[model samples]
Structure formats: structure tokens, C-alpha cells
Target chain A: MNQRNESVEMDNQLAEFSDRILNDEETARAEGLTGELADLEKTVLRLNAAASQEALNEAQSKRMLLRLKERMRREQEEKAPFWKRFFNPQFGFLVVAAALTLFLVVNAPAVVNPDLSGTATSKSGVYVAAGVLTLFMAAYWLMRKK
Target chain B: MQNNSPHQQEISDEVLIRRYLNGEVEVFDLLYYRHLPKVHKRVRYVIPPNDVEDVTQEVFIAAVKALPSFRGDAKFSTWLRTLTNHKVAEYYRKRSRKQEPQIAALTETLAHPDNLSFHSVEERIYLQRALMSLPENYREILLLRFAEGLQFNEIAEAGNRNLEATKSLFRRAVTALRHCLEE
Candidate 1:
């Protein structure tokens, strides 16, 4: 047989031998293995031995599950919608900053134009603050996308 | 009605996925526990011990994020296995970026195996090093047969190869492994 054909034949034999050894070990042993086939059988056995040792015990599994759940919870919180995330304690600073910005904008007319009309300035000031916040958010989003 | 009973082992993974999509989120825990052992085994085969848990967690976390998009074209187990492989690859990629070795050094002291004997841990690491040194296809075939516990025919189907080709690959992989161990 040519080299390729011989290699193919050996492969078929190895696969067959592996099936028999795994499915019916006693029968495979009774039939006896030799040559490269014997060496392949030993290799298969060694791989199996290594695999059998890789099981995660109950305690390990439980500990891993706990850690996984904790991480997933954190992940979920991080991926929460913007509005929902804004309520998180870590965003308290942002909330305060927003409130301060609103206050500054509401009182800016009184500071800049001491004789300016009161009610309309405050209302327009509120709109101005909202508009600035929207523009800031849009710019932030664009930057992130870029 | 979707059964949410914790003891309902007969419910299929697909069913749990459907229920999870239908807002029965708790069913995911069932899927997680059901597949954890096999997924953990596969990850353990390739990853270092200290990082195995982290990598396994990353696999499931990716699964969770991607679960909503899963179309059920393939079996959940198969999908999870693929995800685990991706996460392991990503782990190595990040490690490589950080200038870490691919696999732990052969002479590096191994952490004590949780339940394994000292000799077994050494043997396992030695075998792991040998496996790592193999070409990707060779390593993959061996892992499919051993770590994934796939039969030769099943591996052939999974890899989209003819039975003969798959067997031939298996032979070459084993021979290569033997050579690696001999060295």
C-alpha cells in the first residue's frame, strides 16, 4: 500500500479498536492488541485517566455557582438601562451635580440681569438646563461611539 | 404553564431556555447547574487551576448575555461548548497581550489539586503541557474525544468530516501526542 493508503488503513483500525476498547473493554482485551495499535490503546487509556480526574466536585461546583451568580448580578447591574442605572448610589454625585447645575441656571438671570422678570426667567432657565443636559448627553454618546 | 420546580430534572434545556425567554429567569440556574460539570471539565482541561473558576464563570456570563439571541439551531450543550472554547481563547489572547506564557511552564509548581493526589496532579500537568504543545487540530480532536467525551462518530458529525477522515485525524493526533510525551 502507498503511504497515504497505509495511513488511512491504520486510522480506520485505530478508530475501530478505540470503539471496541471503550464499549467492551474485556472483549477488546481478549482479542489482544499489538504494534502501533497497542501504543494507541495505551495513549487512549491515559487520556481517559486524565479526563476522569477533571470532574468538579460538589463543593467546588457550589462555590463556583455562588461566584458566578455574584458576578452575573454585578454584570446585570452594569448593563441596566441608563434611567435605571441613574438611580444607583454611585450615581449620587451625578444627581447632585445635575441639581446644582439646575440651581445655577435657574438663578443665573437674577445674577446676570438683576431687573429681569422672575417667573419667565426661571421657566426658560429650566428649559435651558434641560437643553444643555440633552446636548451634553448627545455629545457624550457620540464620543463613546467614536 | 412552565414548571419552575427546582426538582424538575426531566425538563429539557431547550424548554428551560424557552421558559427563561418567557420571563421565567430562575430556570437559568437549572440550566447552569445541569451543564456546569461538563463545561467545567472542558475548561479545566485547558485552563490553569487558579483561573479555571474565573474562566468558567466568564463562559456562563457570556452565555447569559447571549442567551436571548440563541435561536436553538444547535443543541444548548453544543452552543455552550463553543462559548466555553471562545472564552478560553479570549483568556489566552488577553494573557498573550499581557506577555504571559501560553500554558504554565512545565517546571512551574502546580497548586495542590483539590481532591487529586500529588502524583496525579503532576501527571495531569505533564499531559496538559503535552496537549498544549500539539497543533490545534490535533489538540482539538483529542479534546473532543476525551474532554468532551464524544464518540469518534459523534466527533465526525460535529466537525463535518467523514468518518474515515475523522478517524485518520484521531490516529494522527494520538501519534503526535505519543511523540510529545516521548520528548
Candidate 2:
């Protein structure tokens, strides 16, 4: 036969072979071919996997372990203790400065004498002390209303 | 209605991906198991037998890693095939730079069994080698039809061509396969 005719014959044979393998009536009826097909497939896959190249090795495993450890360490770092949350020096400084500023704003007038001990107390200090007292009184009244 | 209700198994790729992003890694595995065979077959279509499994693993790994970034615009399978194409191109790129002796070395690695049926693994390997000998476009259509078991319409969609074009391409691919098998 010519090369072309031989190829045509091979194609036909391939198709017929597939049909026979799939349509094994005796095996299908006796043993459930679908299940057999699945099992056979599993075997084929297992064989392929066994003979196939492996993705694992000591180097790759060590790299993966290192990655896992690093990620865990990162997660642990994320979940820091409550005290450690304040470990940020800049943020702590900002917080302390804010707290001191707030304390000075609230209590500075209390230290100043609104009623002057002597004539050394200027009129401006007296006015400033009065404004602070008035603000505090208003804030206290609003809180009481709430 | 109760009997016909679709379970999580029946849920579409979009929903499954949504579940995956919602913190279910196992859902990705389910999707992987569902799609791996087709991906494996497609990889088998393009490359030689020795490299097919490696390509398959690469495809799966890429897919799994990129799942979180999937934007739900394209169909999951289409996106996956696109990724497959990219890997195939990369393989060819790496392959083209290598010397022929290295490729020839792969021939020895092919297990040639005697007394083989046409349906046997040996024959399949032979057929795969023949398919790989064809041009990239011809190989793609043959792989889509035979290995991947996609319809002509699906091939057209994957090829981004019309149905008639895809049909003619597939016929030509089969004809080419016949010629290759003869050679």
C-alpha cells in the first residue's frame, strides 16, 4: 500500500480500537464498566504519577519550610501584645505629647491665680483666667445635661 | 424541585472562585480536580510526551496561584486556556534556544513497548509524537478536538475565529495528522 493509504488505515484502526476498549460488553455488564473505567483511569494516573517527574526535593522543601516559618513569624509579629502595641517610639511620643498638651489645656488655668495675690497680676491674665473658667463651666453644664 | 437542586458541585466557576476568595482553599482543589484533566490533555497536545507532565504541573500551579486575582470578567476555562497558551509559548521559547541534541536525548527517554494495541500507551505516545510534528496552529486544533475533547465551536471560541473557519481548520488538522501518521 501507498504511504497515504497506510495512514488512512492506521486512523481507522485507532478509532476502532478506541471503540472496542470502551464498548467491552462483557466487562461492562459483569463488573460495571463505568466504575472499571474510573479505576483504570486511577491506575493510569497513578502509573503516570509514579513514572513522572517529581516536584519535591530537599532544597524545595527547605525553601517552603522557610517561607512558612517566615510567614508565621510575620503573623505573630502582627498579633503583638497590648503593651507592645505602644512600642512605636514616634507614635508613643506623639501620644504623650498630645496627652500633656491636653492636660495643660485643661488644668493650666487651675494653677493660675484668677484672684490676683497682688497688683503684679496683669488685667490680661485675669481676663484669660476668666475665659478658661467660663469654658469649663459651660462644658460641665453640657455633660450634666447629657 | 428538591431533587433537582444544584449543590456546590454544580455551582459555576464564578461562585466557586467567590467561595475560594471567601477563605476556602479546598474549593480551589475541587476546581483544580475538575479542570486538571482537560488542562493535562491540552498540554499533551502541544509539547512532546517527555515534557507534557511538567507542562501540566506548571499550568496547574500557575492557575492555583492566580485564582485569587481572577476578575470574573472572562469564563474561568477561557482564562485558563489563555494561561495555557502563554505557558506553551514560553516552553517553545525555552525550547528554541536549546540544541537539537538535548531534544534528541528525550527520544531515548520515551518508553517504546512492543506488542502494543493501537489503544495502548505506546500507540498514544506514537500518535502524540506525530501530532507534535505538525505546525503549532494545526497541532492546536487537533489537540482541542482529540486530546482536549472540545467541540469545533469551543475551538472557534478558543481560537477567536468563526465556526466555519474552525471546522475547516479541524478537518485540515485531521488530514495533516493522517499525513503525519503516514510519514
Candidate 3:
């Protein structure tokens, strides 16, 4: 049990040492690398520093900012009322869905009841509802495709 | 609005975020430029070079959308790093769905040992290849610890693990990385 305890202590010490090196805290000199384990520690520090340097693309930054501005503008427009939102393609799905629903309802009476009465027969009502439902489903599918 | 001066650099990310939230939308432009290199580097570590820009952009977009929900519990960079990881994972998921074989091919290319160069370039390339071989969690822990410079507690919180477990994971990750380099 004493040996196991010693092993755990050693592991914790090494872990702490690594943490310090990663944080750039002062530690033992690199010349202390006399064993395989020390060599590994040195390698780890070097690798850590090596990974820290990354190149940035100035051109990509400009392009990304431009796209972000456009997206933010569209988002702002979407927050406006229905009429204002209509100008942005970002709300095209909602627009199409509303349009299709309106079209179905407006034309439903003509197709369902030729008599032009406000009330329709049960069979004709089912047909009208089915037609509206079909149009809605089609609109949904089209929006998803877009 | 181009403020890359030292004084601007002194402004905290949280303060910048607050300013952006409050009417100064141009402050977001500063935040974007400030964090762009970090975001790009983090995404490049996990994603393919070709897709890095798209994933980085997606991370920023998601960050902007979710900014209102950010309650200042963590540093802005840490939050952004977590978002970058999620975006990279999502990118992989989408790619895998579209073409499973492409992921396998990409991994094989990354792991090709013969591609190793010499000097610091060789070391960096070898480390990157080894990192690619590691499990996603292990890679993320190492990146958070070493590259992003997050403390153990911060890493634990970001990873949803306890402090002790995060330390242990970091140790194991270093060991795994060493072994991978040896291979």
C-alpha cells in the first residue's frame, strides 16, 4: 500500500509540474532532462508553445464581417412587422406559408359549394379542409427545400 | 471604428459584449476581430482546413444568436471556445451524414506518418496528426488546457466534469499524446 501511495503522489506531482509548464510558470531548467520522463516533459512544453502560434487570414476576416453584417440586417428586418419582414428573403418561408393558406381559403367556397351559400355540406367541407391541408403540406415541403 | 490600439486591447471581452448588446453594434466588430484568430485556430485544430472558415463563421453566428442568453457565468473566450467545439462536432456530423467514407478518408490522410516534415514544422505536424487520432474529449481537454489556457476548474466547468477528473484527464491526454508521437 505504501508503494501505491507513493505512485499516486508521483503522478500528482508530475501533473502539477505539467500544469505549471503549460501556464508558463517558472520550473526546472531544460538541462534537467537526464531521463526519458524529463525528455517527455521538455517535449510537451515545446509542443505546447508550437501549437500556440496560428496564422490569421485578413481576407477571410473581411468576408466574414461582411456576411455577418448582412445576416444581422436580415435579423433586424425579421423583428419588424409583417409588411417590413416581407422585404427579407430570410422570412420567405413564412410568407409562402401565409400566401398558400390565404389562397386556399379564398378559393375554397367556390370549389366546395357551387351554390355560393355560406354553409357547405359535410362532404364538401371535408374536401375544402383536405385541399387547404394539401396546400399547407406542399408549402411546408417547398420551404424546407429552400 | 478601427480600434486595435493597446487601450482597446485592455477592454475585457465581457465589457465589449455588453457594449455590443447595448446599442454599439460596432463593438461586435471589434470583438470579432479580436477573437477571430483564436476562433480560427481552435476550429482548425478539430476540423479540416478546407472547412475551418465555414465552421468558424458558424460559431460566431451561433454566438451572436445566443448572446442574450449568456449570463456572464464564464469568460467570453471560454464560452466561445465551447461553442467552437460544438460547431466542429456539428460539422463532422453533417459531413458524416452526407458521406461516411469521406470522414474515414480524411482521418487516414491526417494519420499518414510519412507526411511528417523536419524541425519545428515536423513537430507541429506530428502533434496535429496525433491530436487527430485522439478521442474528441481528450483533444478538447488538451486544447482547452494548453492552447486556450483555461485553468483546470474552468476546463472542468466547460467539460461538465469535476476538477479532479479534469486533471486526471489532462494527465492521461498528455500521456496519450506522448505515446502517439512515439508511434
Among these predictions, the greatest TM-score belongs to 1
Candidate numbers, best lDDT first, in rank order: 1, 3, 2
Residue range B1-183, candidate 1, lDDT tens digits? 123465688888999999999999887878888888778778777776556778889999899889999999999998998899899889888877764543452223344345556676666666777887899889988887777778888999999998988998999999999888779
Q: Write the per-residue lDDT of candidate 3 for residues A1-146, one digit (tens) a residue.
A: 99866645644655677678866694454574575456557656755666554456577688888987788777877789988645545366556556657765776666667667555564466466567667766666765634
Report the C-alpha displacement of residue B54, candidate 2, in angstroms. 2.1
In CAPRI terms, model 1 is classed as: acceptable
Greater-DockQ candidate between 1 and 2: 1
Docking class of 2: incorrect
Which regions in candidate 2 have their CA more than 4 angstroms from the true location?
A: A1-146, B1-6, B99-130, B133-136, B156-165, B181-183
Candidate 3 lDDT over residue span B85-133, tens digit each: 7887687778778765334535544665353223444455566667868
Per-candidate Cα lDDT values, in order, are: 0.76, 0.57, 0.70
Better of 2 and 3 by DockQ: 3
Worst lDDT 10-window in candidate 1 chain B = B101-110
User: Tens digits of per-residue lDDT for model 2 on A25-100?
Assistant: 2122224445323443332232222212332344533443355445545666778997786666545445554554
Please provide, for model 1 over A77-127, each residue's C-alpha lDDT reduced to its tens digit, 9 standing for 90 to 100. Answer: 888997896665445545655775777677777656766755666756666
**TM-score of model number 3:** 0.56
Q: What's the CA error at residue A99 for candidate 3, in Å?
A: 25
> Model 3: runs farther than 4 Å from truth?
A1-54, A57-63, A74-82, A85-146, B5-7, B100-137, B150-169, B179-183
Q: Which residue pairs in candidate 1 collide? A: none
Clashing pairs in 3: none
